[model samples]
Every structure is written in structure tokens, then in C-alpha cells.
Target: MALLITDECINCDVCEPACPNEAISEGDDIYVIDPDLCTECVGHFDEPQCVVICPVDCIPHDPNHVETESDLMSKYKRITGK
Candidate 1:
């Protein structure tokens, strides 16, 4: 599943560059993850980079964008063409 940044985010600017898929961005109030591009770092790393580097623990799996490991891998391949 893609990760979501909650309202607890502090706009710390750490997660954006950590994302291998460039799914994280500055939102109006907090960082937002683009589900269409987010792969939870499936093909890029063992864990979600944004989640790993998030200081406030605001990142969480998105229930609305639920996906399996296979699904995340597929999305990663599609985005990276690898």
C-alpha cells in the first residue's frame, strides 16, 4: 500500500527527497504522498524510505490505497520501467 502523511506532519522537508519514486511532495498543510506513484519503495529499497526517515512517525499505510507486495512491485516497475 502507498503511505499517507497525517496531519501531524511538521513539513520537515525530509521525506520528499527520500522517496525513490518522487511520490512525496509539499502539500498545503503537510507532506502528501501520491498513491499512483508510491510503491512503498518496493523495487528501490527494503522499506519505505519516507517512512524510515520520517521524524514524527506521521507516515502510515493508506487503507484507501491498499495494495499487496506484488502490486507494489508492479507499480514500481511501471514507474521505473525496470
Candidate 2:
């Protein structure tokens, strides 16, 4: 599953660069995670970088956007051109 940023984010910009998939971005207020591009670091890292860097703990699993490991790998391949 992909992780999402909640409205509780403080826009501190700490989690943006930490994302291995570059999924996190500045929103109207809190940062937003692009579900289509998010891979939960399946093929890139051992864990979600955004979650590790987020100070407010706003990033959480997106239940509505559940995806399998294969799907996440395919998305990662598409994003990185790997």
C-alpha cells in the first residue's frame, strides 16, 4: 500500500526530499503523496523514507489505494525507467 500525508502536516518540508520515489510534494497546506507514483519503497528502500522523516507522523497507509507487491514494482519501474 501507498502512504498518504494527512492534514496534520506542518509543511516543514522535511519529508519531501526523503521520499525515494519522489512521491511527496507540497500541497495547499500539508504535503501530499501521489498514489500513482508511490511504491512504499518496495524496490528502492527497506522502508518508507517519508514516514521516517515526517515530524508530525502524518504519513499513513492509504487503505483505498491498496496494491500488491507486483503492482508496486511495476509502478516503481515506470517511475525510475528501470
Q: Who wins the TM-score comparison?
A: 1
Model 1 Cα lDDT, one tens digit per residue, 1-82: 8899999999999999999889998888888999999999999999999989999999999999999999999999999999
> Model 1 off-target regions past 4 Å?
none
Point to the candidate with the largest lDDT.
1
The total number of steric clashes, by the backbone 3 Å criterion, in model 1 comes to 0
User: Each model's TM-score?
Assistant: 0.98, 0.91
- Taking the tens digit of each residue's C-alpha lDDT, what string does model 2 give over 1-82? 8889988888898888988878888888778999988999989887888888777888899998999999999999999999
Q: What Cα-based lDDT does every candidate model obtain? A: 0.94, 0.88
